[model samples]
Target: MKIRILRVFAAVLLLSFALPSVAQNVRYEQQGTAYVTAEDQWIADRLVDQAIGAPQGADAQVVFYRTHDQVPGPVRVDGGAGPLALLESGTCVALRLVPGSHAFVIDGRTVTVRVEPGERDYVRITSAPTGPKVAISNALTFLRLVTGKRDPLYASN
Candidate 1:
């Protein structure tokens, strides 16, 4: 009985450590007017540096993914340019933003994102009952999208 109890305790202890590590892998933060994860920050920095002689302008790269399968239709981004569509679930697209403050209407929600020269910003769009929602993607979701991995965002459906 003691041996069985020890084994059960060991299993629980192992899981206690494992679960938090998994949770820690994804984190979110609000940077300026945009929401971003630590991974997004790194990716944006790299992309910005790679742009050869890219003009010093407030630039933004937006990623839109479906969080709920029940959402009706695709989410749309309008303003600061043309209307960009996010078709299908788990689909992601990048948008280029010009410097200064720009108002973008996602679905039916209007969110104002500010971009500063020489800096790259990120935003994420998700589904909501009222309409589409905009926020920053967590590290795990962003990494899965960028790495072409099977994302849980669509797998739950």
Candidate 2:
């Protein structure tokens, strides 16, 4: 039991250090739903467009993934216009965002994210009281899983 516990601890520790010295300086681009948001067709197809590799042109990629499995029901992700994708646990969805500040609408709250040119960012969503909360990760544990060469990452979670 001790060995198994140690292995689990090691895995979490390794994941925590995957980004090494990445400075987690998160910039929120919106405040209190006051910004215009993009309309994603998440419900029409039940999933967002999956991005396996780096984005093209001058856009940056943002991958959204859930952090926990406590929420048994699917979380509804919508845009300003209409319904978006329903997020399930353990799935990764990638979006090619233009190089600028963008707002992510979740759980009736808005989280702002700034995208840099030719850079890739990860968003980890967790359940919160009012709604789902999001944060930027400085680790590649999920990045690798999203961009894994062998397994194609889709909009599952």
Candidate 3:
């Protein structure tokens, strides 16, 4: 009986520690083509809604968007060379990369993408039970997001 109780207690303690690493629930509001955190929407409203176009003669454009899930705390995004952007839930960031292979590390999740010249790539961040799942998306999918096919949501932690 004592051994069973000890095992159960150990399991609970382990789960408690692991919970922080899991994806955090957050609320978001749509602002033009971007989704910004409801709590801090003002800060991102102007930046995301502005007519930020791809730079002239850029090789490729990559947009990392998190519309569904929120990341815990302020996570620094490492774009191979170094920390390039600070990301949180309900925020999106864009990068222009030379036509080549690159790896972007966000919240400890590494996603590798091959960028083609004059092409645009999209990545979506979704919430999972374990953590955030990063997947590559296409222009059509991003279009759906922009066209209001997908609905914005929030979850309570």
Q: Report the Cα RMSD per candidate.
A: 10.7, 16.7, 19.6
- lDDT for 55 in candidate 2 is 63
How far does residue 110 in candidate 2 sit from its true spot (Å)?
1.2
Candidate 1 lDDT:
0.58
| Model 3 spans with C-alpha error above 4 angstroms | 1-51, 70-75, 151-157
Best by lDDT: 3
Off by over 4 Å in 1: 1-60, 65-68, 80-82, 137-141, 144-157
Arrange candidates by TM-score, descending: 3, 2, 1
TM-scores for all candidates: the values are 0.49, 0.52, 0.54
What is the full ranking by lDDT, best candidate first? 3, 2, 1
lDDT (Cα) of model 2: 0.59
lDDT of 2 by residue, 133-153 (tens): 777763334534444443233
Candidate 1 vs candidate 2: which has greater TM-score?
2
Number of the candidate with higher lDDT, 2 or 3: 3
Specify the poorest-scoring 10-residue window by lDDT in model 2.
Answer: 36-45
